[model samples]
Target: MPWAVLRLHRAALAVWGAFLLATIGMLVWEAGINADSVRDRIAACGHDPGLCRIRAVVDYGGTIGWASTLVYYSFFAVAAFAGGALIGRELENGTAQLAWTQSVSPTRWLAATLAVPAVLLVAGGTVFVFVFRWAWAANRDLMGDDWTFNDVFAARGPALVAYGLCALGVGALAGVVLRRSLPALGVACGVMYLINHNLEKSREDLWPTVASGGSGGQFHPESHYWPMHLVETGIVLGVAVVATGAAFWVLRRRTG
Candidate 1:
């Protein structure tokens, strides 16, 4: 059972980590070639060529974008798939019941299963932050030193760390509600993707839902990126807390 959980989460991490590493390679190539073209474009626009935002965004294989994307993607990869399929399948297949009847308690068993994926998820988040920081520092103008550490690093990195940890909680809840893996996967994946996608799409507004901005200057940069992070962090904390509570409830209610 422990081996089953390890294979499930680690495999997912390997798959996603490959993508992240490949993205890094791609960034190095772009920094050498494409960055110059971006520099030209910024110059043409009368913006300072050295401080090209586009190049910065691309530098380090898009560390900023990758930093942000990895958090969401890792959550889905581990939380949605591993929890949805492997662990979910165990319960659905009555394997959990068989294990529970043995010497080990349910809570201990569940905790062990969760450990593999939890470690992988956190590892991924840390790798992304490290890679992004390396890239961001190399191209300060793109990331803009004016940005808060919270905005660039802490927000996405820590939020994702929390999010990946929270996924186990969601899995616990799903385990209690649906005795099968596929249905649980569907519900968790559908909800996670929908919330992440819709909220980010309408980034000018709060996520979990979106809205346009309030009255402000025509070029009000203030109404844009900063507030968006604040809202996003709030949502992350809210969901993490709820998911965690639900997981504990499932364990206690089930006496495992």
Candidate 2:
């Protein structure tokens, strides 16, 4: 059953592998070539406005910024794949039903589908998180990003992996409920977007804000990145668990 699942989703797995490789390559380039060039440019610039305004030096941050943004939002791609390719297409095309009748019980089939992708998602997300954390920290002077930044916060820790797992769960639930590929893809993406958007907005509140001074004081967390991200990760993982359970329950009801 696992082998059949792997065979069916080999294309998706390949695409995921390509994405992982591309992200790793970009991180390596940023940490090596880009970092060195930026350092040289900064040294040359010193206090010279003209040297500081050089295109390569000025644009370095933006170039690497986009790469970080892509890595941060990679969960959306996972959501789309899960909804469209993993579960939805199978249900829409009657492949799932075909498998069910051939010595593969519905629950076991669902387990195989979710488990395989869960492993892949965690592995890929972990790599991105570690690489991104290193790159972001190492190139702090070259970028304008901060711990409070939306993409940076999520990308720096387990929150990124949690988001990917949550997306998978949401996608699976949408696929099972809709039983159609295209609609599930659309709905799952939309739902995940909403969840992410709202969370990004409220993330600061996950941990209490601290005031550093008097009346006109600055308000921020004592530790901005990890604490808030950890809280948000817990929330996202809770959502993933609920969605996965619901998917299993619904599948059992439908098949039984």
Candidate 3:
């Protein structure tokens, strides 16, 4: 079952592997090799604005931002793949039903489908989290963004994995319910956009914000990263659980 699933989704796996490798290489090279040069150039400027506007400085920041942004938005692709290719295409083309009629049971088929990608996503996400954390910490002086930045916050923690898993579950549910490819793709991406947008808007409210003295300004401290991250992760996982359950329920109803 696992082998069949792998063979079926080899294209996606290859793309993910390539993306992971490329991103990791970029982060390591920029942080380990290029960062010092960028810092030195900036320091050499010594308050000279024109000299600070060199290519190395811009490239360093641009590379880091590009990698982080790609990592952060990867879930959209995951959701689209899950809905359009992984689940929806199989169901729409009747391959899933044919598989059930063979040795593979419906429940086992669903489990294998979800489990394979879930494991791969977790592994890839963990590597990305650790690598990004190291890069972000190591190149702090070169970074214009902080822990509170959207891409940095997400790419640095387990929330990245959670978002991917949530996307998978939502996409699976859409595929199972709609039993169509393109519509499921659209629905899954649309739903994820809404979830991500709302959560990002309300993230500061997840943890208590520290208030500035006299001025009465309130903002989350850097220490709130984990608390807020875990809270958001829990919420996302809750959605994943619900969506997975609904997918199963809908599958059983249709099959039985």
Q: Using Cα atoms with residue i matched to residue i, what is each candidate's TM-score against the true structure?
A: 0.66, 0.92, 0.95
Clashes of 2: 0
Candidate 3 root-mean-square deviation in Å:
1.7
Score residue 252 of candidate 2 by CA lDDT.
Answer: 99
Candidate 2 lDDT tens digits, 164-191: 9999999999999998989989988998
lDDT of 1 by residue, 1-256 (tens): 5686666556665776787677556556454456566556666756454455455445533545554554446566655664576567877787777888987677777767766666666776667656555655565544544333333533334555665665655755675577677777777766666656665565544523333469533332433544657666567667867875676567668663
| Cα lDDT listed for each candidate | 0.60, 0.83, 0.90
- Candidate 2: list runs displaced more than 4 Å: 50-58
Provide the global lDDT of candidate 2 against the true structure: 0.83
Clashes of each: 2, 0, 0
Q: Give the best candidate by TM-score.
A: 3
Roughly what TM-score does model 3 have, to 2 decimal places?
0.95
Compare candidates 1 and 2 on lDDT and give the better one: 2
Error of 2 at 125 (Å): 0.8
